[model samples]
Each structure stands twice: as structure tokens, then as C-alpha cells.
Target: METGAEVSGQAGLAPYPVVEEVSSLLNRPADEIDASVSLGERADFSTRVSELNAKSAAGDPAAFYGQQLLLSRIYGLVTQLPEGPTAEGSIVVQEVLRQLEQATIAAEDGMLESGILDAAPAEPTAFLSWLKKLAKEHRVYKHPYYREFIRDQATADDLRHYVIQESVVDGRFDDLLAMMQVGTSGAAKMEIAENFWDEMGNGDPSQVHTHLFNQIYEVFDISPDELERSLTANALLSGNLAVLLCRYRNLYAEAVGFLGMTEWLAPDRFVQVVHAWDRLGLPDIGIVYHKLHITVDSRHAAGWFHNVVVPAAESERMRRAIARGTLWRLNSSARYLDERMPELASHR
Candidate 1:
């Protein structure tokens, strides 16, 4: 079976009159024939889609750029396609989705490297200074997030296998219920629907699933094992700031200041835990970071900003405070990483 890329490329492979013959069959103008066949200088949009999907599965920034541009053009084409809701349009949509899955998978895998969470602790006052520097960066970053969404490598090789995992909680409960209605047991269906409803209702964080909740603390530690497993095994992992930054490098530096600061400072208390564990002469005993970045500093920093900054931010003074807070966040992350992964400084 020819992939979309193959079909798209051959769309223009024949002579102009031959191409006109194909266009006439579809009731499209000759210009449409040329443009669709050309698919742009970098091969047709479909080829770019295939390439972008492949690259994104590996967390490459360039793939993100190309994919975004390709999607924009294809979305326009999708609207104007002669068979808007037929097999042809569905094929293109499926191909686009295949590529998106690849990119998202790559990003999740990239997060698994120890470096993403690697950081060393700094002295209190010095850490404060670091935050000041980073906040300055976040204030000016501007990359929009909602553009060019897709699922690249969803199934093993099947293109139309629902590449991205859809959350039934996103106002799609009835649709899912319809699927379960076919011939499944009423008891099982009701049980699943109730669980879904519970997720949608989120009354308290602690009451959430334990496995779901504890992983929050693991990322603040030195082990990337959980992240590694997640990247390799799952395709519907929740999105985070770091993954978003990797995809949108244009906003990478600025956008991460706030999250970086929170990650850097949120686990301060955890640092104290390391110290206490050491003082008590306890064994390393699952202690990922002894005197370092693993702990509650990032949590505290996140709390302080969310609780203090968002509620009180109104005037120039508040704006300055927010800036100060974000800088402290970003600078601290860089400092922590600089100490933990000095090799990265060359990139800086």
C-alpha cells in the first residue's frame, strides 16, 4: 500500500496534461492540480507530514517547526479538498495524526534523560539571586501553544488506528458510552463510566488515584526511571512545561523560567530531608539526592508564586514581584543544572 507521502509525491510526477487529467477527474482546477502536486518546494505537505512525524517521535525541535508550518498549509487544503468527508480527506487526516503521534512520543522520551531533572542545590541567598535572573527571561517569551497539534506514531504501522489517546472526560463521555453500549455488560460499562465521572469531578487532590498522585514527587528527585518507562511504554502521557518547551524552542527559554523556577525551588524542604537523613546517619536507602536538588524546593516555589503572585498581581509593583519570582525560578534551574550537568554549559 502506498503511504500518503508516496501518493502525494506522484500526484505531480506525471506531465502537466496528465496531471490535468487527474485534476479533472476530481473536478479541481489545473492550478489546484499544480499546487497540490507541488506540495511546496520541500516535497508535498504529505511528505513533510511523514518527515515531521518521524522527527517529532524523537523530540527534535526542527520537526516541531516544520510540522507546524505543514499543518497550517494542509488544514487549508483539507477545507478545500473536493471530497471533504470521504476516503481522501480521511486519509490525509490519518497521515497528519500519524506524524503528531511520533513527535509527542519523542518529546516524552527526551524527558527521560537524567539531565531533564538533574540539578544541584545552591545556598539560600544565592538561590534567591538565581530566581531573579530567570524571571527576567520568562516575562518576554511569546510562543503560542495550540497550533499544529497531531499524533504521529500512534499504532505499530496502521495509519488510522486512533493515534492519540483521547480523554473521554473532555466532554466526550456520551460518545464513549455509546461505544460501550454495543454489547458489553451493563455492570462493566457502568463501572467504567462512574470512574470516568469521578475523574471529571476532581474534588480533592489526595483522593485521586495513588499511583497517579505519587509520581508528582518522583520527578523532583534524581531518578528518571519513571519518565523513561512512561516515554517508552505509554503514548497518552500528560503534557508538561518541559515537553512544551522542547517543542516550541522559540519560547523555550522564556516559557520555562516559571516552570524551571518552580522545579528548582519547589523541593527545598526535600533538600532538608536529605540533610536530615544524612545527619541521622541513615542509609542512602532510596535517597536519590543526598544534599541536592531532590526534595520540596520546587513545590514551595510553585506554591509561593501561585498563591502570592496570581492573586495579588495587579500593579507595577506586583508585576515586578512576578518578574522577580520568575527570574528566581529560571536562574535557580540553570544554576542547579550547571552544577549537575556542567557539560551543558558549553551549549549555554
Candidate 2:
């Protein structure tokens, strides 16, 4: 839960990488932390660090931010914490994530500068069609990471690693869906509400998606200690970005796009994951989430396009926000898959 930046280096050999100029792989930031001076030494390091994100956009940029945001702390910081004075440490961490989010959108510098998502079709149905087409053809479906790191190529531990990393996002999905419901109404509200209901297992506590996800953790014997070690920079960013999009109202439309894209992406990916689970000989109880989602998400994606995206596309502002959110998900997801490959390679 404390996988984010605030405590990333707390028990590790170093503080989070100091905005390094080079990484072990190619030209990305270097993967070194500082133990001599912990990330807790915020005041000491504050002078050199940027008030904005060290990286610019969703891929590496978001991944770095994710390394800092502890999942346990973020829930309280973003939603439950009442109006009150906040610590400077919390302030700095939140600012970094905020800036990273802004930079993600600002990189496009407005949707119009990029492509049609910036300018949606006047007719909502046409816009809906475009979103579906985008989902069908997006580059992430073709990502090398997915190809190299799939069921047939996996070991049992490799399969567990995939599940553990994915749990970063899968673990918190219902809450994210709940966040999207704020200030929403009409078909969009109904759609999200229904989706959330499904996530809740339609009033069956035994069937709640989160409960279902926990089953895998149970099967893997993934204790609290193992969970943190299992998290990677890429997985962290993927989870953090989802939290960032859903927590703030200004990012609401972006959340719609992001969540919608997730619905679009999940079913197919889950299908493969089910294969991986089976191939790895994992227990049936551990894989209910993937098996269920293989069908559920397809239905959710269709309804999302019809009820949520189509209704929201009525306004230009909403259209662009949705586009950015969707693309942000795609970009971060691709980065996550790519970055996670090397982790899997070692397991193989």
C-alpha cells in the first residue's frame, strides 16, 4: 500500500531516483534510489526538485509519480481526509502527481492540436463509433510486451507476478467507479451506476469484484509484505493515474474516457490472462475475476459507449476531456506493459 513516492525509499536502499538523466534501459530516467538521505528528507531535497513532475507526460512521467504515491495513504489524502491542515510532505507528493497530470494533458496542448478526439463528430452516434474503432485498432493491443509476456511463455511465478502487478489497478476499481459517479446524471450516471452495481456483485457480497480479486491474493499466499515488493514503477503509475483521474472533479470527463477505455481493453486481455491462469495450473478460485470480466467488461464497454460516451460527446469540452483521459490510459497502459516485460524476463 505504501508503494508510492512518499515512502518508496523508506525501507529500500535509497530515496526514489533523483530525476536522473539516464536509465538502465535506453534513455529513460536512471533506476537508482538514495539510501544515505531518505525521501523523507523532503526539506533537504526540496531545493533541487521541481515543483512540477520531473518527467513530462503519462508514460515515464506518470510512472515516476506512481513510485511516490503510497496506495494506502492516497485513499485518505484524496477522498476521506476532511478539510484540515496538511503536512508539507503530503503537500509536496500531491503537487508532484498534480503537475504530472497537468503535463500529461498539456503535452497535447489541447486536443485540437492532435487528432479527431480533439474534435469529435457532431452526431453522438458517430463519436461512439469512432471510440469503438479506436479501441479495436489501438496500438496497445499490438504491444510487444503482451506478445512476449503471455500465457504460453509463462512460469507459475511469472503468472503470479502478472496478477500481483495488475492487482495494483484491479484492487481499487470499484472505488474508482464510485468516484466517477460524482456530479454525473442522465444516461451517463445510470450507466456508471449500473457498472458500479455490477462491480458490487449485484448485492452479493460473495461476488463483489474486489472480493473476487482478493481470492487471487489468497491463492498466491500474497501477504502484505509480498505486495509491496511485487509493485513495480510501471504498475505504480498505472494505479496512480487511475486514482488521479477519478479523485478530482475537473478530471471527471477524463475519468469517463479512462474508465471507458479500460472497459474496452479489459475483456480481451482478461481472456488471455485466463489462459495464463489455466496454463500455469493456478486454482480455479484464484481466477474468478478474469473469467468473469472476460464477459462482463465487454458488456460494460458497449453500454459505456452507448450511455456514457455518447451522452458526454454532446459538448466539445467533454469530448476533448474524454479523449485525453482515454489516451492517457492507453499511453500509461502501454508503458506499463512495456516496462513490465523485463521483470517477467527475469522470472522466465
Please report, in order, the local distance difference test score of every candidate based on alpha carbons.
Answer: 0.33, 0.66
Candidate 1, after superposition: displacement of residue 1 in Å?
Answer: 30
User: Candidate 1, after superposition: displacement of residue 134 in Å?
Assistant: 31
Q: What C-alpha RMSD separates each model from the true structure?
A: 22.4, 8.4
Tens digit per residue, CA lDDT, model 2, 1-348: 112234332233223343331111111111222322346554433432343234323334333443344332334345444454433234444444344455444543343325656556667788777666765666576454545567567777777778778876788789999887899878888988999999999999999999999999888788856776567656766776788778789889888888988888887787777887787777999989889998999999889988888888888888878877887787678767766675653543
TM-score of 2: 0.76
lDDT of 1: 0.33
lDDT for predicted candidate 2 compared with the true structure: 0.66
Residue 39 error, candidate 1, Å? 9.6
Model 1: per-residue lDDT, tens digit, 1-348? Answer: 122221221122111221122223243443444445433422454565565566545554334333433332233232233543222333434355445545543553443335322221233333334444444444212101101011111122211111111110111322222332333244433443443344333455543332232332343341323322222112112222223332343433222234434444424434443444444443343233323234333443454344333333333343443343354334333432333224544555
TM-score of each: 0.24, 0.76
Supply candidate 1's per-residue lDDT for 264.
45
Poorest 10 consecutive residues of model 2 by lDDT?
21-30
Runs with alpha carbons beyond 4 Å of true place in candidate 1: 1-43, 54-62, 65-89, 106-188, 196-348
Candidate 1: count of backbone clashes, pairs at least 3 residues apart or interchain: 38
